[model samples]
Target: MKPGADRIELRGLKVRGYHGVFDFERRTGQDFVIDAVLELDLRPAAASDDVNDTVHYGELAERLAAVVSGEPVNLIETLAARLAEVCLADARVAAATVTVHKPQAPIPLEFADVAVVVRRTREESA
Candidate 1:
């Protein structure tokens, strides 16, 4: 693949999660928005028009949701790293970028949102 061209993006994925250092934040929970872009060879899927030719996005999202909501973490960095790891677990995915958004943060000032984003590439072997 080229340096920066092809990608498969999953955007605005909403999930309820408990991730914070504060007890109230963990107990009450909040909505988290996730965006993921996967880089891979799309030629095979493009030619075949078969689900098997590419990574199953629906399944990936489901698993990601599970990971996002399953446990409580202190930082969005941790969440982003774990999600990236999960996405790269699929053999077909060569690289991925994950973003986790926190819209309703516990800050004093007003802002649109807070988030963590990460990009990762597959290991050399397999």
Candidate 2:
């Protein structure tokens, strides 16, 4: 984010997604945690005190959830990138950072979590 840029952040968004390379993983599914940070200028909303002037987080949550729960992708990187795209869809947003966490991964050893983070800008996607 740029200096003084405003942000809207969503954390620990859990969804059961059928995304994995293994057959058992795709069949049973696993919990995916998503964090999305959107950077934008909140000055207009602050001055006007209007919801329209800012991003609606409730709507954004639904959209993000849909992406996580809908189609199945093999890699969390792809998931993160897709989520960043959704975040950058708003014209007001300048940058978005998305992290996809797979807590229950099919790893042989004990681990806290596996995740992929992606950052995207409006200009980059364009």
Candidate 3:
């Protein structure tokens, strides 16, 4: 059960929070959808069925919400990077892909939303 042997997906996690540059944008936040895929080894957790043996997806979602909603960020890239960092912090999660969607982006033209995606892996040098 070495690292980077398992995968977990957290898809379409809808979070409403303040994240923008404009004053109005921060005042009246918008909905942000987050999708994440984590690579880890789940053999230990599988054998014991213990939460401690694996990464808790629910906790990961909450941490992402705190980051996305806690403060305002000018770009989704920053947000996505922050999320990637969070995922990599967990030793079990060898790598992660994070996507942040801003369905309420301000624009004159018609569109569904703007989004950013980032993939990160734990570095051996780190």
Candidate 4:
């Protein structure tokens, strides 16, 4: 978003999914955390005071969870991309920033988390 553009932020959305490379990781689903920042113009919603004028965040969350719990991808990057697609499907959204976190990643050493961030903006067709 630009310096003054309106935005909607969704954070710490956790879902269970089977998205990983290892066989064990796929067989046993793991917890995945997602964060999203949706950039858009909220003036319409603000003035109209109508839910339809703005993106419904509850529905958005459900759609994002469906993507995470749907197909199995080997990379969180791919998962993040799919999530961004869902976010950008709304024509009103100017940009979508998606972050996928994997806390229980199979690493030999102690690590806090592994995550992938993806940002996508609407493409204006001429």
Considering summed lDDT, which 10 consecutive residues are worst modelled in model 1? Answer: 1-10
lDDT of each: 0.88, 0.91, 0.86, 0.91
> For each candidate, how many residue pairs have backbone atoms clashing (under 3 Å)?
0, 0, 1, 0
For model 2 the local lDDT of residue 77 reads 86
Per-candidate TM-score against the hidden true structure: 0.93, 0.95, 0.88, 0.94
After TM-score superposition, what is the CA distance of residue 28 in candidate 4 from its true location, in Å?
0.2
The list of candidate 2 runs beyond 4 A from truth reads 1-4
Stronger candidate by TM-score (2 vs 3): 2
Alpha-carbon error at 80 in model 3, in Å?
A: 0.7
- Runs in model 1 lying further than 4 Å from the true structure: 124-126
Stretches off by above 4 angstroms in model 4 are 1-4, 124-126
Clashing residue pairs for model 3: 6-40
Q: Could you tell me the TM-score of candidate 3?
A: 0.88
Tens digits of per-residue lDDT for model 4 on 1-126?
362289999999999999999999899999999999999999899999999999999999999999999999999999999999999899889889999999999899999889999988887310
- Of the two candidates 1 and 3, the one with more favorable lDDT, higher being better, is 1
- Which runs of model 3 end up more than 4 angstroms from their true locations? 1-5
